[model samples]
Target: MENFIIYMAKASGLIAVFYLAYHILLKKETFFNSNRWFLLAGLFTAAALPLLVYTKTIWVDPVPMAETATRTVTLEQLIAYKQYQQQMAEKAAIEAAAISINWFDVIVGMYLTGVLLFSIRFVLDFLSIRRILSGNIVMKDGRFRLIDSEKARSPFSFFNYIVYNSAQLKQEELAGIIIHEKVHSSQKHSIDMMIGQLFCIVFWFNPLVWMYKRSISQNLEFIADAGAIQVMEDKQAYQKTLLKITVQPDCINLTNNFYQSLIKKRIVMLNKQQSKKLNSWKYAAVLPLLAVFMLLFQVETVAQEKQPAIELIKLPEAKVKFAVQIDKNTQDSELEESKQLLKDEYNADVKYENVTRNPEKEITAIKVTVKDKGQSQVYEVAGHQPIAPFTIEIEKNNSGRNVITFGNSIGKDNFVRAQAFRIDANGDLQDLANDSMHVQKHKIIIGSYGMDGDKMPLRSSVPLKVPEGHWSVNSLKIGDTDMLIVINGVKQKKGDAIKLPLGQEIAELNMVKAKEAKKKYG
Candidate 1:
């Protein structure tokens, strides 16, 4: 919805620019036919220009990663960490619902309401014209069907039908009006009026759109006036005939009416001399205006190369075995469960050794030993200790890409360290790179290349640098979850920690509760 509003705003601005050019450069010219076509073309250009997009590519060096401290934790602590995160998420959701008004929803509702009202008005205007044409035909000819109606205060033409009140005009005045109406019918000026009306209905909120509609209506009249004088014997008499007709309230907006409010301008236009053939150069000015509009609103996508792909080699799998020494603290049920889990999940064998107990018959000590491909490791624990279950698996996803996972699991909670690979035709694994996976660095350019060149950079894909001595979120974490950090008013995403300024560059640092943060940011 936000994107749609932005598109409409850009389109409206284009229409305004096109209309301004016409008013200054082409409106006064005697080229009525040219003016008519130009106005129609302007509407089409405005509607289509913003949709045209160009893509470009640029290459830069990848940014280096900043070093940070890391830590290892037991399985029990990982489970507690996940539970804390779930609680925080539920709390944030509750606070988000507390917001009284969503401005986006309000704006969308208002826009839809306006569209509904204008749509109804458009339908009524069409029905009003249809009613006037019914049961009112007085004469039928090969070219037109003439409707004589008391409701029609002035002469008007709608497609092949001409409507007028014969009782309101003299014989001589009627002849001139018919000639003008006939030109409108022959040229199909009603089609232009209908198009203009539709634009007005859809863009009712834009004042520029209304102005554009007026320009179209006025140009159509001028074309009809020009066509009429060419066929009539006396040009002066036609101008006087235009003055004789009293301006009445506008008829249905769908029709081309003879009595327009611009009668004075019509008289002046009729007396004006023809413009020089060379003055047609003014139309060329539209090319530059169109170029400017494209440069300002058109979207451009650019990509740049920074580094080459890294080759990877697959190694043979290794056999793993585990040895455990049970104490009173190690329940028989837990030991059985852990042994079954290692077998099912990792294809590993587990064996129990000597058991020990204290004077109270409670678990006093436990020991574990691991052997993988002939390499062995041992660890001893006294009292309660967490033993994390580990796994290594190779699988293919829905896209047929190979996924390798090395992780520790506790029920539904998985601490994963994984990578995706694509098998080439030679049956060798290759890294899968995409927009989310950066193999190189790039800068995106979105404006016109000829006008703005590479000066207008929307953003850089390169990592930002943090000043020395700055306190950054690179090392900040909430258990296995990354901490949500905000600097100045901008919330920082993962990997944005390196972009922070130095401690002295920062004037203040503050933190808020999860609920407060959710309410303000959401």
Candidate 2:
């Protein structure tokens, strides 16, 4: 997560700086400097949106729990259980996935790669242009190196040079034309293009990127106009030259002859603002821009505050024995009844056997056979394992009687165990009727840092009724973490690097509902 944040900050900061640099260094004298306001808008919008929606608490683990009731229900989902879930009519529940997505990774990867590629192209293009322009240089007018017009009235480009139809221009107009194109080179407008390309990629789906590209080019044209025309004191001389070459200016000479970049607009701006002069010291705007941008750099926490912890949590006994059978014929009874049977049968039979000495260990051979007659099925979930708290669904097979398998079914004193619950009914593995069971106020710790994890203090009562057998976790903010719809439960200390995009749909839906309600009632 920290890496992700750093990547985003770097990309954003660089884009802002490049935009500013173009305004201050290369095009300060032209209309380019005047358009810094637009870049400033982009800077504000991109930096603020993510921060505003981010939560205050970012450290604690996610907690997923339903807040229906703390009292036990009348149904018996399992023994030692006061109540079970009551059936609820079928409806769509908000997804409570607590995982986060680091879109920053995508941004960083693309930006860096694009920059490298652009640099390579710039060098190659520069080389080709230099080779062509070397033999064609006729004279230097202000910033432009006027070249010989032998080929045709073509506006061809190679690297920085826009080799123009100099034969069509008068001697005076040629100076102005060379100076204008040269301004483009000296200002490193091509470099700006490379940078703009990255922005184009980040906001690839945004139509605004294309519009902005046109805008930057137009601004550059205006800048070159102002700078080139400034060399001559007589406005009439520059205006005559400008109009003379206006018929067909230089272009990249590609299949698309449409320079919708608005050269006409560039000329008009140059005329209207001809008298205005720029003070180079205006570059001081950089300080405040940097100052404001610094405010946007954030730490990679889910949120940035502390939250309360759970009040009473019931944990299983540290060392409980489990008998797993690979035979797949074990009775699928609930945990309570099975627990009673185990209590009676294995009470005296609970003897630890060392694998080395006991070759004929009957305990290892004992299996809990489960029978399934369904047509099709996929068992994605293996019993929960390390790092990843739960097993991801294996595949999307909706049909079949699938057997839930486990590797570490048995437990010992060293390895702690709990009284596990199993889904007994065949109708649906999930508890759709959520009110079936009720548990007292017991909270699970989540998104923790160490073995002695960071606990979110629980102020509000988060009692549970089994919803779909997985417990209700969505819509509830987990502790202080920026997680929305995180599960409320004890968590193993891992997977802290997850980021902000997880479960965003549920959070947004909640916000949307709140907005609709406000509009309707108010």
Candidates in order, TM-scores: namely: 0.62, 0.38
Tens-place lDDT digits, model 1, residues 357-450: 5666565554544333343444454543343333323233355433333333212211111122333344333433221422122221111111
Q: Model 2, stretches more than 4 Å misplaced?
A: 1-31, 34-131, 134-146, 152-162, 197-206, 245-250, 253-263, 273-317, 322-522
Question: Pick by lDDT: which candidate is best?
Answer: 1
Give stretches of model 1 more than 4 Å off.
63-71, 74-80, 95-100, 309-522
Number of colliding residue pairs in model 1: 7
Assess candidate 1 and give its TM-score to the true structure.
0.62
**Model 2 alpha-carbon miss at residue 177, Å:** 1.9
Put down candidate 2 lDDT per residue, 1-522, tens digits, no spaces: 565565455545545564655444535354364653445445445545345332344464223332221111111212322222212212212223345565767766765686577556556645655565676755654544455656534443323455666566677766666666666667666655554555565544445554555556556556666777677566667665545444554443121111224446655666674335555444555656655554555433354323323232233111112232112122224323443433442231112112121233212223233222332222222221211111101111235223233332211111111111223333212323323222323233221111233332211222234333323232222233322222233332232421222112111111112233244333
Look at candidate 1 and tell me the lDDT of residue 315: 21
